[model samples]
Target: MHNWNDPGGKGSACQADKDRKDATRIAGQLNIPIHIRDFSQNYWDDVFRHFLDEYAAGRTPNPDVLCNREIKFKTFLQAAIDLGAGCIATGHYARIRKHQGHYQLLRGCDPDKDQSYFLHTLGQQQLAQACFPIGDLRKPQVRELARQAGFATYDKKDSTGVCFIGERDFRKFLAHYLPAQPGFILDTQGHPLGEHPGALYFTLGQRQGLGLGGVQGAHQAPWYVVGKNVTHNTLTVAQGDAGHWLDALRLLTSQPSWVAEKPPGKSFLCTAKTRYRQPDQSCQVQVLDDHCEVIFEQAQRAPTPGQAVVFYAEELCLGGATIEATDAAFGGLEAST
Candidate 1:
């Protein structure tokens, strides 16, 4: 496996010191010669710069997804093939199956920990050569398997934050490069109700940290972030009322992928999840040449623009795409065509 050391080979200087140490320990235990490349400063700096550039362009790019598709699968796969590796695998929670001479993507059995959404950006070729050892098992089962196998990370707390940057508060990490700018907090009706520290700090459906108070005042009933206008520096919010939060939406997806032999045509029924943590909701899917749209049966809240919307038909993962737009007006509709 190929891994890059974060800046200065500073296994000692960076927050990822523990990871480096763990990697070393694992390699020693497995008797594997781990080759470490020192891209260090240039690699990390370039990634962060690209992230800021995308965000500034009003596009919510999932950096992890990009890294996996572009670097890990594409670049690393080629390198591994050159070195005569038979196959590659990762800790991803996605399953691959062969159907009609094509590779299909499926959700891991662990409902709560499925990560097929992150792997949605991968194409057909990558899916063919990838393996997921823990795909069929739940988190607890994986831990038990690890314990039985005598692996040290059997009980290691799940790693949080970005792939190699280690766990840091997202706002704090971004603030280091992108300073927060104060913005206006508005109600759904475009009424100014409060002030936000920065538009970049908040996301759709976020409830905490708005600093709004009172029993019956603006944001008094535990407001949820509804929308954001980055250009105007305004964040729209709503109370946690069923009527205010959305139940359904018209999700415009760009650059869709299919793991099946045939693409589901326009207006087909399926289940989908807007966020990784959310349960798959019953919905109808429509496939276009370049995009697919989903309309959930029940209203879902905070379908953020930059996040993935993964679709499923029972156990199989059809595909997913980044949420491009949402319509509050279409929330109560039976279907969104």
Candidate 2:
């Protein structure tokens, strides 16, 4: 098991060292020689220089996705090859299948826990050397398998917060690096209702904790966050009408990975998922240069930017991309374009 704990900030080296000590101690007890690589200083100084700089300027960065593609798969694979290791393994829940003469990446069987979407940025070469031991199993089956193998982490609570950086309150974490700016909560029609602590603390589909007191409609029903006008520092709220959420979305993704022998011409039908936990929805996928457009047969609510959009056909994962934007105009099946 490899633990890459680089938080991309000052004093991360010390933290990484402490984590390594703990990991080494545990590995010794289990008679496993675990290799712990400390890349904190290098990550902050090198791999994430631009992202860290952007965060310093108050921009949110998806460091987890970047780490998987650029560092763990790219740099670490090279290091492993140099060390005479033929394959690299990870805890990612994606699958690899041999097609024709090449390996292709696919979503795991557990739809609720599939993580292939975040891995779409990886190229064909990385997929060839990657191994996901738990790809074919469900969450419960994985736990049972771990228990049968006498692994203590069988019952371990799922880790939260940013990957490797450990747990932290979302606002507190961002506040450590970015300045907090208060924002307003507004209705779909632009009526001010309440205030939010910061724009960065909220997401496109969030529902609770807006601190909006005078929210009038849906007196008994809960409200959900439908959208956010980042430039104006305003959040749009709506009654928990599942119908008003989302139906279709257009994404602008960079560095796409295709598992197909040849790109599908014009459009093709596939099972698409906007979020990890969501069941695969029927949709038509159109691959474009630098991006792919997904038109869902059913409206999806609050398709947030920076999240992944994965596609599947039966058991094969065609590919996926980051959701750059969404449109509510296609709110229902009949409204699809």
TM-score of 1: 0.84
Among all windows of 10 consecutive residues in model 1, the one with the lowest summed lDDT is: 328-337
Which consecutive 10 residues in model 2 have the weakest lDDT in total? 328-337
**lDDT per residue (tens digit) for residues 114-217 in model 2:** 78776766767888888999888899998897788666667867654465445446566566666667888877788888888766666655667876545565
The models' CA-based lDDT, in order, is 0.70, 0.66
Q: What shift in Å separates residue 50 of candidate 2 from its native position after superposition?
A: 7.3
Q: Which parts of model 2 have CA positions greater than 4 angstroms off? A: 1-32, 41-63, 139-150, 216-220, 245-255, 260-262, 329-337
Candidate 1, residues 1-337: lDDT per residue as tens digits? Answer: 3234544343324545566777788888889977654444443554556667756644566777666766668767776777787678888887888888888888888877788877776667888888988899899999998789777888988865565545446666566667868888877788887898777777666788887776344444678776677788787777866345544456776767665535677678988888766777998888877787777777677576767787888888887777777765422223445
Q: Against the hidden reference, what TM-scores do the models get? A: 0.84, 0.80
Report how far off residue 324 is in candidate 2 (Å).
1.8
Off by over 4 Å in 1: 1-15, 38-50, 57-60, 214-219, 242-247, 260-262, 329-337
Candidate 1 Cα deviation (angstroms), residue 209: 1.7
